[model samples]
Target: MNPRSTATAHVDTFARDRLPPPDQWPDLRFDLPELRYPDRLNAAAELLEGGAGRPVFRTPSGDVWSYGELRARVDRLAHLLTRDLGVVPGNRVLLRGPTTPWLAACWLAVLKAGAIAVTVLAQQRPSELSRMCEIARVRHALCDIRCVDDLAEAGVPGLRITTYGGDGPDDLLRRPAPSTPYPAVDTAADDVALIAFTSGTTGRPKGCAHLHRDVLAIADTFSRHVLRPRADDLFAGSPPLGFTFGLGGLVIFPMRAGACSLLLERAGPRELLPAIAEHRVSVLFTAPTAYRAMLAAPGTYDLSSLRRCVSAGENLPAATWRAWYERTGLRLINGIGATELLHIFVSAADEQIRPGTTGVPVPGWQAEVQDAHGRPVPDGEPGLLAVRGPVGCRYLDDPRQREYVRGGWNITGDLYVRDPDGWFRYVARADDMIVSAGYNIAGPEVEEALLRHPDVVEAAVVGRPDARRGQVVVAFAVLKEGAERDAEALRAFVRAELAPYKCPREIVFRTALPRTATGKLQRFRLPGDGYAESSAREDAGSPTGRETGGDRQ
Candidate 1:
């Protein structure tokens, strides 16, 4: 099916018209029969109707909704959107809320009505929300009553907002809705379905536009091939629905496989560990930090039901991976994905996993280690990682699109090495490499060594300005409770672990590390102080270190 030749169902052509010029777009390939979607398709209907009568979402309080029930809710919301709110096809609708059934229903409703979904984290400040609304040109919003304050205060001109999950007369759930099924919009398969912005903390956000076909392609490729699930699998995770990783893992992947997912609104490791045990979740998805935190309190969780675990949103340190496997006997499936490509593109199944390396590309995807000039580098040479598949990067009216997609491949800003065995090993982010005395040192390598230390729970290494050495390695470490705060001792430990030149010249002790909403470490946010106030508390012989909640998904 020639996607470009089909007539769009959108009444508003703003989104499609603003896409990067066709010449700059990466090569889009439908490499599998399953990826060849119909010309006229609504991704929500395709995902929901296939699993009718099957359990789809489960709440922590024992509440459950089957596929049929969720579909009816979504249909009602879709009908209300077009009928009452005057929403038309291609209208951008903002969705903000915690991870709940209502939030999921709102997302599907927007897609079902052929309206573009603009999902944002509930934690965003009013200023941030305002900036996002301006960037996407979003006016209509479906905000949870708890989150309405920020959206309303964002002051988006003429925003028609409908509050849900409230008892008020104007609340969306309070409105009388028809129970009959509403026909899903007949949108072109290439029509944009949702715009997922980056989860970084600083700078203006970059919105990644994804098509309706991409929503389903991720499930067909990664979910079906790498993390194969049975119909009875009970999934659970800590990521918010706003993040693409969570949207796929907690919702799309589970629904595509006819499995039920337990949605936790407060899903830190403390909350998620018990939820997995209470709900008997068979499949778990979270960042490497959450996995390590769970490993910290191992005996308390009855993790007998967990058979498959996935780690992403940050690099999975080999020491953390090995510790989890040794404790739970489940190998962490480490994968690298981006908001640009949608979901996990490179990952391995249970036995296919290599301990320290992100595995080969998934079926229907091609990846390579490329140098600065976009040419492929020899195996084992560190270079920029470039990949392309059914789903590729499409930024929403941002000039960075030209930089992200180059020469028919999405040049993910990750530094990687393709070993002779064809597995891709993560080095560090391209910008995270430090040049110390003409030797290139990857920060994650130093962090990985620090994580292997018994007392260190979390570590982040960055390049600090050093006039003599060009740039010196600096590490911020969060130690376990009661562990000694001896920076020199830790520096010596890394010297013994790796080459002495790679060792951090200074170690700063902190109670907690700064992270973005999706739990990725914001290395730029690290403070310049040699030691934080927590170190002063340690000097006074007082306990320091804060409890790590759930990581961003």
Candidate 2:
């Protein structure tokens, strides 16, 4: 659709009278001010100055760093980068390591020294790291000693590699002492502060360039509206510092709120629980899978200190939310954020939450459900989810920039429904929808229903190509411990709970479903040749009449 035509159509569907004016929303005090220098707006500089001599972070090892001490360390590293390493403004410095107070300091040091920081996931493979370095033209990489070997194997040449850990030449512990405080360089608002590489399910990764102002814009909108952290609140989470979700949860929001962040060197479900218990962490940010895993842990960990738990990266099932709140008094705040938006555009505070819904859009953003042609759908009808927020995403020279931004609206790949009261309920992605015999099915909806089953530990539903039907619903299930994986019994259970068309045509038992590093289910990996092999074995052993089930139309 043409740009002008699309805009006109969108306006007609969501007329001004039909939607509430943005100004009528509750005022959030965290909005970013227009700065004189856009390119050099360093968050570390702003927060450190305001929070000087105050505690910034706490570690489980009984280590604590006041803002003054953190700034002093950052200054020393900044000087070393400028003098010894010759790093300059706009230089892309790749930060590779797990979350640590030192890692946070290094991030600020790089930015404080006037260089753009590109955070690489510590768990990323050599090839993935290589692609990122090549795309960003990273001049320096501060990585863990364990990751240095992979960086070498990735063939990223001419890049200075600094290692962290025991006896390493460039260990953060051995960095030179600071002679003076590093001064913040003047930067333009449009200058890129960080580049986050998004995992592409279709093609090579794309770097989402976030401007300095964009950082504050996110903190202004979602953080103010959803989190509302106080100085006494200690924020922590399981997402690595590399993910924007973690960066916001662990550093930006807390620092913006003048609160302390607890940085765990290792953050998995196992590690996260202990850190929370030991440190009395009040706020958490993690994926739904991690929350589920924490509940499944063999031993009980004291989580009473936790006041707010935020879940993103994937759809939050109602069953997961109920299970979490029932076990612990905290409700998992469901927010929908994309790499483009930098943070969640929609979220609900604990008091305002509707269990399964993706909540109302933040004060500064507008969301609508649109049909295939980009026309807004009626309330309660599922369609493409489009959002327009203060923090706009500008891709680095990618054609997708044009495809994503249509008529001044960001068309997220997600499909959703907007209720009359304006709550947004997430459906499957437009690309992830399964079509069988002309029936359009959302995979996530089926997965959500399956999760409600007591015997089901985890399930991923995908479309499998069929000769009779265009596609058939196939479920990859991981049953609970001591639970039976009998195909017929499981199918019977699904048939009882879901519509005949929505029930899985076949159930394939697996030890576990494959997931991305961020804990999102990797549905693309399903319905591969492995499924065919498993199907062959199942069909060969099954009796003739048993193959056709009541649920199979």
Candidate 3:
């Protein structure tokens, strides 16, 4: 099972060698025979080559790019990458750009040229990009013209960079290519296609290596069985293309079904509502926080065209789910996915929807709640959530791989409780659980209780060290406009819904809670001196300061 055997002849073998030991990897299961891919597979060939004349992408400004047009553009870009830039199969090409038709073209071109696509978020600072360059040993970058300066600031030695968009002479979009169409390379299904970095909650981000087959496996399992997108359905979302959530929702899922995807450069809740109405977007992918924000301006936009609304990135509280359903009569599709698994493994569609629970495992995967001894916990008990599917974690050269994969399952870091009927209820992250006076307190459970208060706009619960107790549950909350900030009253509100031990010992009022770009809460920033510093930073510039709804997973 040497990973190197499947790598293309032209790629750098460093990544292949860095994969987790064969024993540590989970057994990939493709229950559906069609999920079994060929020995030599090029993902771009499947994503871009098959669709002939259907509309593929549309910009916010109303420009449309059909499948035929996008295919020609991708072929030309692939030719330029191989012929002009000497990019051979297996070389890692960094792709940095906002969500746009050209950015999609660049990504597919890199894969079509038989190179691994390393997608970096456009908002990432130089320091972050510099660290990625070091870890992946990336040497070439295809970036937006605006990000060219940041790439230079990274100061990676011998790093070659190309720019797209803008009126520059050497713009990647305007570069000429040889007339010949560059056929997709024949890469092994197991050959690495992308190196998606995890959100650095602890320390440096770890790169997750995904194979050519893994890309389509997610589409087949989650998209095919659960979401069930149609060719005429228009997909849109707020997630940046760099996020696996966005990669699946905005690009891969749509292309897999020959559906059209609307590309919006700035897709916050405010922007997304109008785009959904104007473009008649059918399937929506976003976090719970965005769904909460959009609930504010009810009846402001025509969202009748939206049939399916998917929520992930964090836990979806039952309150938010109820509020959204009450407002639009559309049940929110709640699922939990991680960077390692590629996309949602557990989810229920329209009729099977459950408000608070994160549904059963998708058709191609198996899940269970495990205790510290690596044994399954009884129903109604909380423990680690472990899953095995066609796609799982393969951290590139990281020792933490041993901690993530145990036995034959990928142990997702979240803590959960499984009911007798097998629905998984999220409690908190393994690290976010507060051990106070020997009582286990799930922070999200307390946060959900606080969110039930009409005056509470947003809330984040964390464990603050206490002298009498090892740690006490403390909450930072943002109140609605003109609402009084009475800590005792808020504490009483929470006590009414939860046990006294689970209620927050103290409530701190804040303009906003710190969250990541993808909208996940930053629990680590809540305790100790970090609280004051984060509060000050939020007060100074966080946009969510005036807005309700904190980011979710």
User: What TM-score does each of the candidates earn?
Assistant: 0.95, 0.88, 0.94
Q: Any runs in candidate 3 off by more than 4 Å, and if so which?
A: 1-9, 528-553
Return whichever of 1 and 3 wins on lDDT.
1
- The regions of model 2 sitting more than 4 angstroms off are 1-40, 166-173, 528-530, 533-553
TM-score of candidate 3 against the unseen true structure: 0.94
- Best by TM-score, which number? 1
Model 2 is weakest, by summed lDDT over 10 consecutive residues, at 544-553
Cα-based lDDT for every prediction: 0.86, 0.74, 0.84
Q: Please give, for residues 293-343, the per-residue lDDT of candidate 3 as tens digits.
A: 788644689889998899999899999999999988999999988888888
lDDT score, candidate 3, position 449: 95
Candidate 1, residue 501: lDDT = 95
lDDT tens digits by residue: candidate 2, 260-326: 9998877778899888888899998888888988988888778889988899888999999999989
